[model samples]
Every structure is written in structure tokens, then in C-alpha cells.
Target chain A: MKQWMTLLNKELLEMTRNFKWIWVPIVFILIAVMEPITAYYMPQIIDSLGDLPDGAVIELPVPSAEEVLVASLSQYNTLGLLVIILSSMGIIAGERKSGVAGLILVKPVSYTAFVTAKWAGAMLLLWISYFIGYFVSWYYVGILFDTIPFIDFIQSFFIYGLWLSFVLTITVFFNSFLKSPGAVGFLSFAAVIVLIVISGTFSKWFEWSPAQLLSYASTFIMSGPISSDVWAAIILSVSGIIMLLGGSIAIFRRKELA
Target chain B: MSVVHVKNLKKNYQKHEVIKGIDFELMDKKCIALLGANGAGKTTTLQMLSGLMKPTNGEILFSGSREGDDFRHLIGYLPQHPVFYDWMTGREFLEYAGKLSGLSKKDSKKRTQELLELVGIEEAKNRRIGKYSGGMKQRLGIAQAIIHRPKLVILDEPVSALDPFGRREVLELMGRLKKETAILFSTHILNDAEEVCDEILFLHNGRLVESGTMEQLRDKHQQAKIDLEFKEDAARYADLFTALVKVQSHAIKRNKISFFVEDIELAKIGFLKVIAERNLPLVKFEISRTSLEEVFMKVVEK
Candidate 1:
């Protein structure tokens, strides 16, 4: 436990030194704030562009707070996920490539501790950035549209957070063996995209898939109630994260740090 | 007492075996040089001993520990090229290493400071490792390797990548470090093996071809040899020296010839008579014992 904490501190320090703490949250906030602002001013933006015919009456329906929040999540699902994946793709692979893994692994430290510390550090960053982005989007939704209930908002936030955690866990797992950060990011993103596509196309079959957590989150926010499948999806995603972490440690132990 | 004992240790990567069943023991409080040419499995052996790599077959017994026991805490290792977190300062990196080695917070900090001073990098303790010079980085590497005060420290070609000044600094530091804990370092440089090591383990083609105390190995393999340097072309004299009846073997390079002799006295007399009679352009002639380089070459060739 002590060793894990020490390694965790080191990982956090690395993140801070890399300015991940500053820029990641800044990007998240910017993406989140853009959602409601764009939705609220679409007519004005379109009017200022003068692309329509002269004196043409434009009928644009105002989106609800829930719809705005969902739109923000969809934006995060693309751009936000890309940023998170890119930032963390190098966490394990870079250390191994740089030969730092050999230096640390030679000590009495357990592989489990080393891997868990990395996961925890990435999760911490994810939570901070996700919450800040979600809450800021919620605040903008309240100003532009109707206010969402706090209970429903928090529940939706956690379910979406589970999806982010699952993505990061996959990144860490691939990073354990892959040498190139770009390859890890590309493969992991491809995996996530496939999961999202499968879940959307075959919702009846993948209702309990971990990928459904995002849809469940958006559903909970828009309707204030989730089906039994949401609970199943949460359980699956959480277990998947744990298994990925364990698999990373197991593979890392057998890997030759050359 | 031996700190580490290996019996027929072997590591095979697929069909090609890197370590072909080599065995040696590391004695307490002694510095052992693992001498080998490149591609000779020195790093592979060190990695297996440090628990970074697993041996395919054979046993590594740590002192007072069973076969399956975890002995990593009792050993410290420095790779050939030690990489660090560039964002971390020297002090923070050492502290992190110390903590990883099971040192407590206070103990880690204290040892970190002491090691910074011991390795002669106290002034750069707060400087990030990215800004450090090669010598300072090596010093920090050495400092981190011994921060836990393990029973044994393994260094893989510790000075092979450094400049002369940096090499001298690390060698001198290794001299001091051996007093506190046993050290097993691998180097291709025979002079480095001779300068600080008490014992030498020479590896060739994945086998322990020769190993003994520096004096013991020298005495065991020592041969009477003569070195002759000519002012003009020495190849001109190579044929005459090779024809001498007492000359067992001869190696020539540029303007110098080293002749290994069956009988030093007879060979010296005949060579001197030829030099006097012919008045060859001789610049230097000396009789001396065989050097470690010759022994290494002879062993590797065999």
C-alpha cells in the first residue's frame, strides 16, 4: 500500500509537470461551454452569416436543458474522448520505451502496485476533468434553458464517467505491450468506435454491453429515469475496468523491459 | 560468505540461447567485474539476477533465502543506459527510488540527501534530470542504485557510455561503493576491471570461460612476453621474429610486435643478438608479463 501511494504520488507529479492538469480541464471546459452557447445562438449565427434569402423567416426550435446536456455529452464522446486517449496513450508505453520501467521494476516494487498507481492517476484526472466539464455544461444549460434536477444530473454524470473509465482502462491495457503511443491511441479509439457502433446498431442485443453506459447516461438525464439495463451496463463496465487493469499487470510482469 | 550463488543459469530466447548455462558466486563485500565482449549475455545475466528477466533454467540462490523467495529488496540494479523521469529533479527521483526500494518517507529523504552527496551531485539535487549533464546523470543513476543500501548492487557497463572524465568519476565512486555493499558490474574495458575489481568473471559466447580474483587469473594465465617497437616498418621484422625457434606465437600491429615465448631467456638473447648484428631500427624493447587484454583475447578465441 505504501509503495503504491509513493508511485501514485510520482505519477501525479508527472502529470502536473507535464501540465496535464491545466490543459486537459481547460479543453474539457471549452468543449462543454461550446455546446449550450452554439445551441442557443444558432439562429443568430446563421442570421449573421447571411446565407439565407433576404427576409426569409427562419423557424428554429429552442432545445431543452436535457437536450443541451446530451448534445454536450455527444461532443465529449468525440473530441473529449480523443483528448483523453491521446494524453494517456503514452503512460505505460513511454515508460517502457524510455527504459524507466527497467529502473523501477528492478526494485522490490510489485507489478500490481505499479499498474494500479497508473490507473488511479489516470482515473483521478478523468474524474476531475469530466466533472468540471459536465458541471459547467449543466450551469450553461440552466442559464439557456430549464434547470436539470441535481439528483438526475449527478447520476447521469457517474454513468458517463464509467464509460470514460472504461476507455482509459483499455488504453492502459494496450499500453502495457504496445511501444508506440500513436498505435495504442489509434487502436483503443478504434475499439471504442466499434463498441459505440455495435451498441447503436444492435441496441436490443448490446443493451447490457459496457458501451451502452453512455446511452444510459444520456437517457437518465433526458428522462430522469433509467431502465434495469443501465444497472447491468454499469456493472459490466466496472468489472471490465477491473479485469483490464488486472490483465495489464499480468502482462507487464512477464514483459522483458529492454 | 557468498551473497549470490548461481548454478547452471541459462536463458534462451526462442531457439537462440543467450546465457548458455553459466555459473558463478558473488562474495560478500567484494567487487566483481563481469568482463565480456558485446553480445556476450552480460546484460541478460544481470537482468535475470536483478529479477527483471527470468532464467529459462537453473537456480539463483540469494543468501539466507530459499529458491522461490523474493530477494529483489536485497539487490539494486543500474542498467547500461539508465533513464529517468525528465520532469523530476535529482532529489525527487532519488526519493522516489528510495521509496520504491521500501524506504520510509523520512528514511528515504535522508538517504536521498546522503546519496546525492556521496555521488558528488549535492549541488544539482534540485535541478531537473533533463537539464543534467551526462556525468551528473550517471552520478544520479549510481546514487539511485544504492539508495536502499542493498546487500548487492548490479551495474551494467556503468561507465561504458561516459566520457573520460565521467568514466573516472563513476569508477572512483564505484571504488568507494564497494566498501559498503557487494558490487557486480559488467564492462568490456579490461583496465576498468583491473582498476577496481577484486574478482573478474570473463564471459565469452554466453559461457563463463574464466573467473577468479584479478591476481589469481593473472597468475594462472600469465605468460612471459616481449614487446618490440621499431622506428620504421615493424612488419619488416615480423618474419625474422616469427622464425625464431623460441618464439611460441607472435602478434603484430603497425610498428609493434608482441612475441609470446616458450623460453624467455633464450628468445631474449637471440632477439638481442639479431638486433645487434643487423642493427635494426629499434625504438623500444621490453620483457613483461601478459596483460588482461591478451588473456581475454586468448580466452574468447578458445
Candidate 2:
């Protein structure tokens, strides 16, 4: 337990000292602030089509609370995806490439503790970033829509946490096996793309696929209760986390430092 | 008790056998130098002993309660080329290493400071390792290796990258470690093995060709050579020296001459008697011990 704490602290210190939090938070903030600002200006952007030579009449619908939530939530999802890729690339691959893993492995810490700490630390950073974005989106939604669902916002984040956990595991798995940050990112991005494709292409598993969670994050924010599909997505995503983590530990156990 | 025990260890990479059935025992509080040419399995042996790489066939046992799974924490290993996080400072690196080795956060921080001081890098502790010189990296490498104060320290060419001054300091620090810990270091440079090592393990072509105290190895394998300089021109009595029984080979360059003999004791005695009888003033003649380089060359040649 103490060893795990030391590793956790060391990991936390790394994130804090490296100014990683600065960029992480900024990225989320930009997305959060952009959501409502984009929503408030979106109609104006369409109205600017008045410059069309044909003078075509276009019907515009009033942006509802659901529309506002979806716009902000989708923007937040895109930003979260970027956060997962950027932050995770360094989590395990950086340690391995820098030769830091050898020193740590030689120590008294268990592999489980080391992997868990790394996974937890990365997830914690992303979680913080996600919530900051969540707060900003909520504040903007209140400004534009004149209403805020505080309890609903918190619950939506809880569900979003499950999806971020899935991203964290995939990052770790590739980080261990692949030593390059870019390669890990490329592989992870490809995996996410494939998951998205699979969910879209196969109607049967679409609801259960982990990819469904990212799209449904907006639904939760609009006072949509956590549905059976969300539960299935959580289960599937967590299962992927277990397999990836297990493979990482197994590969690390046999890796030759020299 | 031997802190490390390797019995008939073997490692093969594909069809090529890197370490062909080698064995060695490392007892507590003793430093052993593993000297060999490149590809002689010195690094491979060190890697296996540190448990970083598994051998194809062998039984490696650590002494006492510190054995098997728990044995890892008791061994400190410095690889030939240590890779460190470029972003982390030397102090942070050591703290990370210490924590991994099972030290508490408080203890790891304290030990990191102490190790930095020990390696004479306290001033540069805050500097990221990427900015360090070659020597500084090597020192930091050693610092991290010994942070836990393991029972056995395996340095795979630790000083190979350091400057002469840095090498000397690292050697001195290693020598100091001899009082408390056991070190098994591999080096292609025999001088390093000679300067600090208590014993030598010579490897040639993936086998343990020879191993002993420096003195024992010299006495066992060396063909004594005498640096002979006569009071008069030494070259004049070349035939006279060869005429004496016991001298197997003799070389004369200018006035100074050198002779090789199977038995240095016998040859020394005979040469002196000849000098006295000839009434030749002997300016200088001394039996020289075989240099570690000579020993290495001879072992590798065989």
C-alpha cells in the first residue's frame, strides 16, 4: 500500500511539475467556453447566409435546452478525446523509453501497484480536465438557456468517467507494448476509429459498444436518465480495461531492460 | 555465504550460444570484476545475474531469506547503457528509483539526496538528466542503482562512458561500497578491473576462461619477462645471457635487453650469477608482474 502511494505521489508530482495540468485544463476550458459561445452565435452564422444571391428562405428552429446540451456535450466529447490521446501517450511509453521503468521495476513495488498507479494518475488528470470543461459548459448553458441542472450535470460526469476509464486502459496497453508516443497515439486513434466504425456498422452491438458512451454524454446532460445502453457500454468498456491492463503487466514482466 | 550463486548457466540467442555453461559464486562484501572482450558474454552474464534476463539453462540462488521473488529488491543493477527520463531531474530520478525499490516516500526523498551527494552531483540534482554530461549520467546511473542499498550491485560497464577523472571517482565510490556491499562489475578495460577489483573473472568466446585473484592469475599463467639493463652495454652479453640455462626467449633492442623464462625464480638466480662471474655491472634488472592487459590479451588469444 505504501509503495503504491509512493508511486502515485511520484506520478502526481510529474504531472504537476511538468505543466501538464496547465495545458490539460486549458484545452478543456477552451472546449467548455466554445460550446455556449458557438451555440449563441450559431444562428447568427446561419443568418449570414442572407448574402446568398438567390435569396433563399431558410427556416431556423429555436435552440432548446436539449440542443444547447447536445452542442456543448459534443464539443466536450471531442475535447475529451483529444485529452485522452495527448495525456496518455506519455503515461507508460515515456517511462519505458526513458529507461525509468527499469529503475522502478527493480524496486520493491509490485507490478500491479505500478500499473494501477499509472492508470489511476492518467485517469485522474483526465477526470479533472473533464469536470473543468463540464463546469464551463454548465455555466454557459445557464447564461444562454437560463437554467442549470446541477445534479444532472454531476451524474452525467459520472457516466463520462466510465468512458474516460476505457481510454485510459487502451492508452496504457499500447504505451507498454509500443515505445514511441506518436505510434501509441496513432494506434489508439485507430482503435477508437475502429470502435466507432464497429458501433456504427453493426446495429446490434451499437448500444453496448464502448463507443456509444461518448455520443450519449450529451443525453445525460439534457436530463436523460442513465439508460440500459449506458450500463452495457460501461460493462464492455471496463472489460476492455481488464484485458489491456493484464497484457501490459504480462509483457512488462518479461521485458529485458538491457 | 555466497550472496549470488550461478551453476552451469547457459544462454543462447538463436543458434549462437552466448554463455556456454558458466558458473560463479559471489559471497557477501566482496567486489568481483568480470573482464572480457566484446561478445565474450560478460554483459550477458551480468544481465542474467541481475535477473533482468533469464538464462536458457541455470540455477541462480540468492543467499538466506533474501531469495527468489524477494531477491529482486536486494540486487541493484546498472546496465551498460542506462536510459533515464529526460524530463526528470537527477534528484527526482533517484526518488523514483528509491520508491520503486520499496522505500517510503520520505525515505526515498532522503536517500535521493544522500545518493546525489555520494555521486558528487548535489549541485546538478535539480537539473534534468537530459542536460547532464556523459559522466554525470553515469554517476546518476550509479546513484539510482544503489539507492536501495541492495545486497548485490551489478554494474555493467558503469565507468565505460566516464572521463578519466569521473572514472576514478566512480571507482573510489565503488571501492568504498566494498566495505558494505558486494559488486559484480563487467568491463572490457582490464585496467579498471585491475585498479579496484578484488578478483577477476575472465571470459573468452562465451565461456569462463579464467578467474582468480590478480596475483594468483599472474602466477598461474604468466611467463615471466625481465627488464634487463646492464651496467655496461646490455646488448653485448645477449649470447652470454641466452647461454645461461632457463631463459626460453630473449629480445635485445639497443643496449637494453629483456628475457622471457618459464621459471622467473630460476632465471633470476641464474642471470645474477652470470653477471657476477662476468664481472658485469648490472645497472637494472627486475622481474615484472604481468599487466592486466597482458593477461587479458593472452586469455583472449587462447
Candidate 3:
């Protein structure tokens, strides 16, 4: 347990020194805050599109606060996912490449503790960054449009957080065995893309899939009381994360350091 | 006391064998050097002993420990090129290493300071490792390895990357450290292996070709010799020395003539007397112990 914390501290320290603590959240907040601001100013932006042929009358409907907020959240579906993956891609693999893993693994520390510490570190950053950007988005939605369902807002917060966690976990999972950070990112991005595409294509079948959790996140923003299928997707996503972490620890132990 | 006993250790990566069935014992509080050419499997053997890599077939028995025991805490390892997180301060990296080695929080901090001072990097403890020079980084690497004060400390080519001054600093530090703990280091530079190492193990082409104390290796492999310089090309006066003394053999190379003899004391006296009696112009005459390079050559050449 102590070894895990020491590693966790080291992991966070690396991110902090590189200003990852600042940029990762800023990226998420920008993606989160952009949708609401753009939606609120669309009419004026269109009007000011340089002499719009007098009475071009672009009849654009104003989206509801919940809709605008979900739009902001949807931005995370792609951009936020990428940010998480890209930021986390090198956490494990970089250590191995630079030979730091050899130093750390040679100690009395267990592989489970090492991998868990890394996962927990990334998860902490993910949660804090996601929460801060998300809170800012909520504040924006309240000011620009009607306030979103308060309780529903909280539920979707976790659902989306889990989805992002799913993405980060996948990246960390691949990094444990693979040596190249680029390859890890590519394979993880491919995995998430596959899930998104398959679930988007076969909604009825993949409703219990982890990808369904992302749609479920937006659903929680729109309404209350989710169906059993959404619950199934939630369980699957959580299980997938646990399994990935568990498998990463196992594979990490079997892999040689030098 | 033997710190660790390795028996018939062998490692194979698929079809290619790396360490072929070698046996050796590491004694407590002694410095041993693993001398080898690059690709002689020095690194592989050290890795296996450090528990970083498993031997495909062999037994590594730590003193008083059985199979399935968790003895990693008792071994400290520094790789050839240690990579530290650039952002971490010298003190932070050492403290982290200590904690990972199972030291308590208070103990880890205290040990970190002690190691920083011992490695002579205390003044730069606050500085990030990224800012350290090659020598300082190596000192830090050595510090981290012995943080837990393990029974055995394994270093792979500790000074091979440093400049001349850095190498001297590290070698001097190793000279101090050997008094407290057992150090097993690998180096291709025979001088390094000779300077600080009390025992030497030579790995040549994936086998334990030779290993012994410095004196034992020197006596067994080397024939004491006398070198003569006559101010001019000594090779021109080869016959004058051969007739003066019945050496086992005589050879001329460059400006000096060498008499290879089993008995260096008698050979030295005879050569000196012949030079004085003949009124020969002798600029230098000296009896020399065989260099580790010579012993290393004899072992690896085979």
C-alpha cells in the first residue's frame, strides 16, 4: 500500500512538473465551454457574417439549455476522449522506453501496486480535470440557457466520467505490454473507435456495451430514471475497467524489464 | 559468508543461448567485477541475478532463502544506463527509491539524506536530476542502488559512460563503498575491474571462462617478465640479452626487448648485472606484474 502511494505520488509529480495538471483540464474545459458559448452567440455570429445579403434571415432555432449542455458534453465524446488517451498514452510506455521501469520494478514493490498506482494517478487527473471543466460547462449552461436537470446533471456527470475512464483505462491497458507510446495510443484509439462505431451502428444489441454508456450520459442530461439496459452498460463499463487494470498488472509481471 | 550462490545458470532467448551454465558465489562485503567484451552476456547475467530477468535454467539461491521467497528487498541493482524522472529532485528520487525498497517514511527521508551526503551530491539534492552532469547522475544512481543497504549491490558498467574525471570520482566512491557492502559491477575496461575489484569473473562469449582473485588470476595466467630499453631500438640488441641470460624466451617489439621468464627475481638480477658488466646504455629496466588487460586478453582470446 505504501509503495503504491509512493509511485502514485511520483506519477502525479511528473504530470505536475510538465504542466499536465494545467493543460489537460484546460483542454477539456475549452471543449466543454465552447459548445454553450457558440450556441448562445450563433444568431449574432451568423448576422455578423459580413453583410449577409440584407435579410438573409438565417432561421436558426435556439437549442434548450439541456440540449446545449449535452452538446457541450458531446464535444467530449471525441475531443475529450482523445485528450485523455493522448495524455495517458505515454505514462507506462514512456517509463519502459526511457528505462525508468527497470529501476522501479527492480525494487521490492509488486507489479500490482505499480500498475494500480499508475492507474490511480491517471484516474485522479481525469476526475479532477473532467470535474472542473464539467462544472464550468454547467455554470455556462445555466447562464446561457435554462438550467439543466440538477440531479440528472450529476448522474450523467458520472456516466460520462466512466466513459472517459473507459477510454483512459484502455490506453493504460495497452501501454503495459506495448513499448511504443504511439502504438499504444493508436491501438487504444482504434479500440474505442471500434466500440463507438459498433455501438452506434447496432444500438439495440450494443445497448449493454460500454459504448452505450456515452449515449446514456447524454440521456441522463435529458431525462430522469434510466432503463435497465443503461444499467447493464454501466455495469459492463465498470467491469471492463476492473478487468483491464487486473490484466495490466498480470501482463506487466510476466514481461521482462531489461 | 556467501551472499548468493548461483549454480549452473543458463539463459536462452528462443534458440540462441546467452548465459551457458555458469556457477559462481558472491561473498559478503567484497567487490567483484564481471569483465567481458560487449555482448559477452554480462548484462544478461547481472539482470538475472538482480531478479529483473529470470534464468531459463539454473538456481539462484540467496543465502538462507528458499524457493518462492520474496528476497528482492535484499538486493539492490543499478543498470548500465539508469533513467530517472527528470522532474524529480535528487532527494525526491532517493526517497522514492528507499520507500520502494520497503523503508519507513521517516527512515526513507533519513536514508535519502545520508545517501546524498555519502554520494557527495548533498549540495545538489534540491536540484532536479535532469540538471545533473554525467558524474553526478552516476553518483545518484549508485546512491539509489544502496538506499536500502541490501546484502548485495549489483551495478552494470557503472562508470563506462562517464568522462575521465567522472570515472575517477565514481571509482573513488566505489573504493569507499566496498568497505560497507558487497558490490558486483561489470565493466569492459580491465583497469576499472582491476582497480577496485578484489575478485574478477570473466564472461566471454556466454560462458564463465575465468574467475579468481586478482593475485590468483595474475599468477596463473601471467609469466613475470623483464623489459629493457637501451636508449636506441632495443630490438637491435636482442642477441646481447639472450646470450647474457638463459630466459625461457626473448622477444623484440618496437624499441624494447622483453625476456619472458618463470622466475622474475632471478631474471631481473641477471639482466641488471649483464647491463652493468657490458657497460650497455640501459635507459630503463623494470620488473612488472601482468596487467589485467593481459590476463583479460588471455581469457577472452580463447
Candidate 4:
């Protein structure tokens, strides 16, 4: 038990020192503050296009509460993906470069412990960032509209963070196998694109695609009722989390620390 | 009792055998220096002994057993090119290494400070390792290796990267470690080996060509040397000296005539008689003892 803690501590300390711990929270906060603020003011900026020409009845569609939720979520989700990739990119890939892996592998700790600790620590940091961002989003949206409640805001953002966790887990798994962070990041993004395209083509497989997980998150925040499809998406996201984490540990164990 | 015992050890990377069937024993608390040219299987041997790599055949016994897990508790290793996280301080690096060696948090902290002081890096202990000079980094590497008081420590070319002053300091630290642990290090620098090692294990062409105490190895290759400086026209007396023939071999270098002889006392006696017979001029005449450097070069070549 002590040995495992030592190994876990080493992993966490490494993450703290290497800029992972600090940047995740900063980026997530930026997303949180920027999301609702952008949503609240997007209308005025669009309307300031000035008076239309005489007889040119160009009527702009009214921005509703649904539009506010969707626009804010879209912006937040982009930053959320960035935080996920940035934090998970160096989990194992950096260890291989720094020769830190050599020091830990000689001890009694198994490869299982090494990978599991890396994933768990990274997940913890990501979750913390997501929560902070969610709180900021709720507060900022409330400042914009007095009627937005905190509990409803959390419920909407929780599913988005969970969906992002699945994507982050995949990034962590690829990080273990790939030689460079650039390669892992690029490959993971490419794989996500392919999955999105396939889901769009096959209606039956939409629930399994991680894209649905993200899309349904925005649907919930717009005050739309959670459907059977949303639950299915949640179940698929959980399954993905398991496969990614399990595959990472297995591949990492077989890899010889060169 | 031997601290390390390797029997029929073999390691292969696919088709090529890096470490062939090799066997050796290291005695307790003695500094053993491993000398081999690059690609002579020195690194591979150290890796297996430290449990960083498993042997493909045979066994490595620590305290008379092949238990890999507990065996590492008694072994500390420093690789030729060690890697460290760029952002961590020297103290953090050693503390982490100490913890991995099963030291408690308080003990790890205490030992980290002690080792930093021992290696003369106490002032730089809190600085990030990435910002350190190569010599400072090497000192940190040594500190971590000895932090846990391992019984057997293996360092691979530990001083090869340091400057002359840094080399001297590290070599001195290693000399001190000789009293506390059975130190085994590999280096191509013959002088470092001569200065710090009690026994030298000469590996050549993937085989143990010679292994013994420095004096023992020197004695095995001992040949008396006679250095004669001529007062007047030494070149003129070269033919005459070679012809007298008590010398095994003689090389003329400017004003000095260096002769390899079978017996120093016999050569002295013969030299005195020849000087009297020829009434030759003599500036200096002395017999030289064989140095460890000469023995190392000769044995390694064979």
C-alpha cells in the first residue's frame, strides 16, 4: 500500500511540476467566463449590422434561450477539448522522454499501477477544471439573465464533462503508445473525426459515437427534455472510458522502456 | 560472501546476443571497475544486475537468490545517460527516488538533504534539474543512487561527462562510497579506473579476458624497465648497448634510452660492468616499475 502511494505521489508531483496542474484550471476558467458572456452579447453584435436598405426586408431570426445555451456550450466545448488534450498528452509520453519511467519501473510497482495512476491523476485534474468552469458558467449566465438556476446549469454541464472525459481517456491511451505528443494529439483528433463522420452516416450508430454525447449535452442545457437517446449516449461514453483506460494499461505494460 | 553472483547469464535482442554466457562474482564492500570498449556488453551486464532488464538465460543471485523484487532494494544503479523530469528540483528528484526505494517520507526528505550535501549540491538542491550544469546533474544522479544506502551500487561511466574538476570531485565521492557499499562502475577512462578501483574486470570482445586486483594484474604483466640518459653522444652508443644484450627490448627516444629488461638487479649489475669495460659516460640510470596503465592496455588488447 505504501509503495503504491509513493508511485502515485510521484505521478501527481510530476503532473504538478510539468505545467499540467496550472494550465488546466486556467484554460477551463477562461472557457467558463467566455462561454456565457459570449452567449449573452452575441445578439447585439449581430444586430449592429445597421439599418437594411429600403424595401430590403432582411429580418434577422430572434436569438432565444435555446440559442443562448447552444452558443455558450459550443464555445465552452471547444476550450474543453483543448484542456483535455493538453493535460493528457504528456501523461505517459513525457515519462518516456524524461527517463522518469526508468526510475519507477525498477521498483516493485506493476505497470498496471503506473498507467492507472497516470489516468486517474489526469482525470482528477480535468474534472476539477471542468467543475470550476461549470460554476463560472452558471454565475456568468445568471449575471446575464436572473432566471438561470445553478442546479439546472450543473446538470447540463456534468454530462458534457463526462463526455469530454471519454475523449480525454482516448488521448491518454494513445499517448502511451505513440512516441510524440504531437502524434498522439493529431491521431486522436483524426480518429474523433472519423467516428463523427461514421455516426452521421449511420443513424442507428449515432448513440455510440462520442459526438452524440457532446451534442446531447448542449440539448440538455437548452432546457430540452433528456431523452432515451441521451441515456444511450451516456452508456456508450462510459463503455468508451473503460476500453480506453484498460487498453492503455495493457499496451503500457508490454512496452519496454527504451 | 559475494554480493552479486551471475551464472551462465545470457541476453539476446532478437538475432544478436548482447550478453553471452558470462559468469562472475563480486565480493562485498570492494570497488570493482568494469573496463570495456563500447559495445563490449558492459551496459547490458549492468542492466541485468540491477533488474532493469531480465536475463534471457541463467540466473543472477543477490544474497543467494534470484528474487528480482527484493533484490533491487539492495542494488542502486546509475545509467550512462540518466533522464530526469525537467521541472523538478534536485531535492525532489532524489526524494522521489528515495521513496521508490521504500524509504519513508521523513527518511526520504532527510536523506535527500544529506545526499545533496554529500555531493556538494546543497545550494543547488532546490533548483530545477533542467537548469543545472552537466556536472551538477551528475552529482544529483550519484546522490540519488546512494540515498537508500544500497548494498551494491552500479554506475555506468559515471564521470565520463564531467569536466576535469567535476571528475575529480565525483571520483572522490565514489572513493568514499567504496567504504559503504560494493561499488562497481564501468569506464573507458583508464585513469579513473586506476584511481578509484581496487579490482579491474577487463572485458574484451564480449568475454572476460582478465579480472583481478590491480596489483595482481600488474604483477602478471610485470617487466622491468631501465632508463639510461647518455652524457655524450647517446646515438653512438646505441649499437653497442643493443649488442651487449641483457635488455629484452630497447627504444631510443632522443637523449633517453629506455630498455625493457628481464631482471632489474641483473641488468644493473651488467650495466655497471659494461660501464667500467667501455669507460662510457653516464648521466642517469634508473629502473622503472610497471604501471597499472601499461598492464591495462596490454591485457585488454589480448
Candidate ranking (lDDT, best to worst): 1, 3, 2, 4
Candidate 3 chain A lDDT trough over 10 residues, lowest sum:
A48-57
Task: State the RMSD for candidate 3.
Answer: 1.9
Off by over 4 Å in 1: B231-245, B252-256, B262-281
lDDT of each: 0.91, 0.80, 0.88, 0.78
DockQ of each: 0.78, 0.44, 0.81, 0.43
Candidate 4's error at B125, in angstroms?
A: 2.9
Cα lDDT tens digits for candidate 1, A110-168: 88998899989999998999899889999989988889998888988999889988999
Per-residue C-alpha lDDT of model 4 across residues B8-71, encoded as one tens digit per residue: 8888999888877888889888999999888888988888787777788988888755555457
Candidate 4 stretches with Cα past 4 Å from truth are A7-19, A32-35, A46-58, A76-79, A107-110, A145-151, A222-236, B13-16, B67-70, B227-242, B246-258, B271-286
What is the Cα-based lDDT of residue B178 in candidate 3?
A: 86
- Order by DockQ, highest first: 3, 1, 2, 4
- Where is the poorest 10-residue window by lDDT in model 3 chain B? B239-248
TM-scores for all predictions: 0.95, 0.88, 0.95, 0.87
lDDT of 1: 0.91
Model 3 alpha-carbon miss at residue B32, Å:
0.8
lDDT per residue as tens, model 3, B30-86: 999999999999999999998888889988999989965777888889999888988
Query: What TM-score does chain B of candidate 2 reach?
Result: 0.87
